[model samples]
Target: MRSSVPGTAKKFPLHPGHPERICWGCDKYCPASDMACGNGSSRTQHPAEIFGDDWFEPDPGADDAGAGREG
Candidate 1:
């Protein structure tokens, strides 16, 4: 059965290293290179795997570094 709630898949970047292989269907992290959830029904896929390494790039001119903030 399809879920009525819109589900957002957790995105794992490859830059930091050792991106975990987690099941988007559930909360368990499957590291065995196999589907460990839903009896091989849901496929596990990372954001970088589908959209390339720069998939999660920051917004342009967003000023996220707190450039003018005082201590």
Candidate 2:
């Protein structure tokens, strides 16, 4: 199924070659200098920048099986 909102269905790159050159704030993928969202003065940094190269990888310590479940 496709997303109802525009640009929301686009596949985001897990490891963009130049993450800093583009704005990760929205699906527009606008250049860092030109943010289409107009929500902030500065461009949002890609997750890879703050979380490192393994940003998409699951955390080994996270207990996925127990998430949202009560004992």
lDDT of 1 by residue, 7-43 (tens): 8444433453444455444546565367666547655
Q: Candidates' lDDT values, in order?
A: 0.57, 0.84
Clashing pairs in 1: none
Per-candidate TM-scores read 0.39, 0.73
Alpha-carbon RMSD, each predicted model = 10.9, 4.7
* Candidate 2 regions with alpha-carbon error over 4 angstroms: 1-8, 64-71
- Per-residue alpha-carbon lDDT of model 2 for 6-48, expressed as tens digits? 7666777899999999888876788998788885898889999
Q: What TM-score number comes out for model 2?
A: 0.73
Model 2: lowest-lDDT 10 consecutive positions: 1-10
